[model samples]
Target: MANTPAIGYKFDDISEINTSKDAWAVVATPIRLWVVPSFSGKKLPYSMELVLMDAKGGKIHASVRQSLIYKFQPLMNEGRVYQISSFGVEESRGDFRTTGHGYKINFQFSTSVRLVKDLPINRSPYSFMPLSDVALNNPDSYYLIDVMGILTGYSEELEFEKDGKKNKKMTIEIEQDGVRMECAFFGNYVAEVLGQIAAGDKNNAVIVIQLAKIKPFRGKISLQNAYGSTRILFNPDVEGANSLRQRFLEAHEPAAQVLNHLPNSGKISVSDDFLKRHWGKTVEQIKNMRANLKPSQSFSIPLEHNRTIEHNKQNALLATGSWGMRAWILESEVCLRPPW
Candidate 1:
């Protein structure tokens, strides 16, 4: 008998696949994969969502229905190369679409998925939007975006009742190139971000949030998590993060050097003589002084205790300005006994 030749299957580019095709095959990597829950509040699995990227850097959203999740979940892994074929193609529709690709893949019973031992795609799957541009984003925008910045501050986790269920939320402030923006994480994401901060250094930590939605809350624009699709990375070891860290360091190097060279570098003393000179200044005057202050220059004004301002034993206020103008009250005996 003559030797039989194996049949070859052709793969289509992610960008080329559309609803017009019945049989489609593609070699792509699942950059992100997560299970979505039912919107009916039944606490049941709805479907498995994935953001897949081809070797050419084209990305498309893919979904495995709740019933087929068991069959496909085991066969696919994030960041791993796979040969997927015979999947259904449909028009992408969602209030918060993960990708800009007009079409998305729908895994069917006959959908074939197998692991490929080839090297995965090396290109970055992120198209990060600048913090400055965030304000310009339309609140009703359909597509989600990726963003990375330095974690400057965060609020306490708050619990609230919604739909007769308890939900948690936390707001974090991130800054990039002197521009600051707030992002709110809800549900399990509250714990996820806080856990990462606890595990690592939270000060000036580089945080990368992928597939974030731009939302308007209380008449202010903010970034928010898009259910299970949002991925949070803290101090990620990537090119963008390294570059941001480098820029931050370079910008603050002068302030850091100045602090290092100062005698008793960690402590600032407010003498009675210093307090006497600033004691009579009103809060408005102090605000004006701060407004006129130059970089790396600061002025301190003693606040009058009218039983309104909270104070500890020391009661000292220290105002300092560096690369970024920062002011904070310090605990010192000088503040405890103000010179009238």
Candidate 2:
């Protein structure tokens, strides 16, 4: 698959299956999506395509793969290509009822659109160097940060589809500003950030965004660390131009307040006796100590899987750029290595 020609699409990744002519006998799973573009503060969802494309760029007969009703769902409002939602792996056999006949990969849905600029940038703005005497705790403000993190835990338990597809509905835990917060990914819309962020990495950039208060649930006593329990769709112009990094760094420049002042937002001190410190304190206590660094300082690696980001990056650059599905276990995972 390394030699597979790159296709032009928004997924930024792709995975091809190893199949043969025998695949035609198995049922092709179909997916239906509702597309909605917000206009005037209201959202309207509509149905779109039923596509059947072969690996060689030919259209497969939808009826032969599944019932007429199941094979004819819309492609999408944005006209993205469709893939098997859950298909059988039976070889030259039409046995929907047989075990070992097939398996499933979670169907993925995505839409790539440019931000209208005026469209609100969600989340908190910069802190630290860009700080002021004013404490703006509004829930709807956006922030500028270059730091990239990963989803460590989800509030809701995850569920898989019939054919072993991964359907996860959970809040992400992003380690930002030396703290972790609850983030979220919706339905099939979770954009895979495989190569972008790692577990304990911190990269800074300049920015001007906002910070706001939020409550994950009702009756909650204290506020949450999340700007919102929302998966923010970053503006491509900013993401592509590295403006997000720029904005994040701008916030950390020396100023009225440094991030290190706060216990949770401060830099971590590393020492050969790091484990000795843990003996006398609770995890939270030691964590708070680490967080209480001066704004000018940084933190230590908190997770052993820190290599997650770099590992995914090679996988990301190797696949085709399509927004629909990000293939993780594809053979091409080994193709794209960074130049020394």
TM-score winner among the candidates? 1
Against the reference, the lDDT scores of all candidates come to 0.71, 0.26
- At residue 58, what lDDT does model 2 achieve? 26
What is the per-residue lDDT of model 1 for residues 222-321, given as tens digits with 9 covering 90 to 100?
7779889999999888677878877877776544322111111111124322333224444354444555555556544333222122222233243321
| Candidate 1 regions with alpha-carbon error over 4 angstroms | 1-8, 41-44, 137-140, 252-340
Model 2 lDDT, full chain set: 0.26
TM-score, one value per model: 0.70, 0.22
Candidate 2: residue 303 lDDT (0-100): 22
Evaluate model 1: give its TM-score: 0.70
